[model samples]
Target: MSFFDRFKNPKTAEEKKRIRQERLLLILSGVLLGISFPPFPFPFSLLAFVAFIPFLLVIERRETLLTLNKATYLMSFVFSLITLYWVGSWQPESDPFLMAGGIALLLAYPCVMLIASTLYYLSGKIFPKKINLWFFPVYWVLTEYLLTLTDIHFPWILLGHGQVKFLAFIQAADIIGTFGLSLVVFYINVFLYKAFSNYKNNNRYSVNYLVAGVSIFLLFVVYGLIRISSIELPNRKVRVGLIQPDINPWKKWGTGSLDKMVDDYLSLSQQAVDSGAQIIFWPETALPVYLMGGNYQNEVDKIYSFLEKNKVTLLSGMPDIQYYFNKEDAPADAKFNKSTNSYYTAYNALIELTPGTRNYKRYGKMKLVPLGEHVPFSEEFSFLADIFKWGVGLGGWNIGKDTLVFKVPVENNLGKDTISVSGLICFESVFPIFVAAFVQRGAEFIAVVTNDSWYGNSSGPYQHKDFAILRAVENRRSVVRAANGGISCIINPLGEIEAETKMFTKDVLVGDVVLNKEKTFYTEHPKIVTAIISIFSLWVVGINILLFIKKKFDL
Candidate 1:
């Protein structure tokens, strides 16, 4: 029979009530889970684990033959709808319907979430009830592990992402990255689920759940204490300055506000210099015009000259546009490799200025944002350039090739150190691996330049800045973040905000913090920690397979 036919015309109202309960359980779980997204902040984060107990209990302990497939999909649907709401928030003006299509994708991806739930449920079904409790957490952790593939896999709302605000809880991030908290969150939920399911009937399960939960909580406490005590942060401070220009991008780029924008930055930088800053940083795309071009060569030289005379290292986020040709004047749509085969402008960027340096050195930003930096299918399906607004003259951005390092000789009251600095522009700071790459490549300090003006007064800037602080803590490196509309701050290697400027304010903060030459685990081997977790995940999968074989053969 068909799906609905199986449950249709139930002889008793009891059957209808059971179906209704299943639907409610799934939808509620999905919606509550979305709160686990960023902005809620942790140890308020532990609330998300509570959401899972009800949902998982309902899915695993169902008595009827009404398969969980439908409920799981609905749960996934509700989740993606709320969690990935930002995707639909940004729509191209040309096609308003594109927003709706983007929103639809959020629900469509619920299939994968449903599949994840299905695997976990299958493990519980095959194993003994007592053993299943342990496997439930393991299975869920494995599900989260596999959710890190490119394009398709979505790892956005992993439980730890919610802990962005809590420094102490997130200290674990330095050791195991965000995935560890995901496993812990689900492990707690699994124990709770069994506790609730076995309540009244056994009552014993609840005690076990409490014991396990308390144990995990204590372990995290011990972990935090150990990390804070054992890991002595090397004396790595920098005399840093952050300038917030408070310029509107639309008016600056599209209107006649160019002069005003330039004046805002120059004034901010001078103010920072007056405050005795040894290094000054400006926000992303700070320069309205190309400084290095032959036409503007004199201006670029002038900025360098001023910086040198001031004895300060000036880090500015400016776009360095370069024309690229396959041979000579190859058509704009010329192909390179299969991935990036479009002929257009490429970026020669991330320039650093030190007072008295002969010339400025630059590093182009790698790992560009999907639509904002370069259109995905523009190379394979090249028509996206002209037809759809992905052209150099308009919407498209040129990709940068190299990672820029800014070498500076920093001096303190006690002594001086030769420090190598690098920058992560805008969304580049959001990617842990990318920032870790810079640290591995001999960068002693991180300078994150972001323009959150487009994001407006939402929690966007705070959320973005919060993640940047994690990079600092994870690498034990000082981070200086310069933004267009404030939330500009200095983050120490321990993930503490040593100093911060107010949001949406025209402010310049200058302070003396050390920049060190010491090494950090996250800086040394980025993928190493994530790789160890990945291996543990594979072991969980292997155990599940072994158990399945034992069940099938009755061995």
Candidate 2:
């Protein structure tokens, strides 16, 4: 028998029925949590909220703390497992073991869930009088709010992500950020829980309860539909050429060579310019060649000349290097690296290259790709760090501490106008906070450069396309993405895909992207409000701790 079976006693039929229902809830929670991960449709998220209701209704009310704790762990485990399993599947054959190990360690969500569950459990006891029908919703909001502030945030498959497919309901994300939608989902789930619990307990239905349960929903549904339909994208003066360089990451890094890589991008960029393109963008690492000033000056000079001759400002990703210096040998606040072979640098970064112009900017990616970019803190799964066949840079990739915002002078029909745009390299598009920061820093338009060739030609690119839509909605900003190996798209603030290219195809996605100065709540200040909410939750936990301590003394 299982270990839990030994502790169990034979139950009567009534008790058996309750236990069965609880088990069903747990399984339902697991499936919903799994669906919340990508490679599935967004409408599936309604199931997550629906599933939470049964657990709240059927699980013993007194054991609410413990029951939810188990539920949290179970759901979190399923989520982390399904989401992170791509590590092993994508790993090169030689280092499959390392990929397997890294996948386990990087998945720290279960522990985070366990912590949140414990805090809420104590609140259930300490605030017993105030643990109203809204308690569960409040607790869930607190957890999500806390998750974003902490360093170990992997904001993939958020509740707001679930509405990427449903553009009408999601347009409000610009005002409240993705968290607002998440709050609504929790609100509905908690209301449903209260409804189910009340109905199951008695034969009579309370009209007061029904109104209390669904009133917010009715208001939200009405307001959401109205806002989505009423608002139209205001005209802004801006035009950009999204550079879609279809290059495979493996071949670009391997013996297959970067000759095609360099030629294809340069040729496409020239074409965009000839077609009256002002600002051109290339996908992440589209220029697979390493750029070290002076040393690779000859190679780097050619790219610079191309930009100036074409008279188009080119924002592209290349292999960027900085010198690594020992901390002891370097002065505090040193601007440049002074260690390796006459001024080598310590990091790899995404750099902005302007033709005929000496002024350029570089932004190191802040959130590195797990395993693919960097390893987790603990060495328990350190073996997983060694698995990238085409991946370079040892130890870890350098993280940019602040927002990498830049401006470029462009030639438009309106006149010689300067546009402010920020680059979100690869996975950063999925991170809402990062996107918000760039917007806050006067980035009128969001430009994302990605090399989706890592996942091959499959659902990976399609899934990423979903997030591109979310970025536009969540920030209330127009977004243009340049992807290597297809799915390059231009999305408007209203979550409309203006134009998109197909997967695994050599294609150009052309569209008119407008630049706007109209700021949304998320774009103005993304995490500042959420940070306040998270701080209040800590206070709630503190109060619960005091109650726990006082009770212990009384005993």
lDDT, candidate 1, 159-184, per-residue tens:
66666666666677666666666667
TM-scores for all candidates? 0.81, 0.86
**Candidate 1, poorest ten consecutive residues by summed lDDT:** 89-98
lDDT on C-alpha atoms for all candidate structures: 0.66, 0.66
Residue range 282-368, candidate 2, lDDT tens digits: 787765455644365655676788887887777776556554355555433223433442323333456778866676788877766
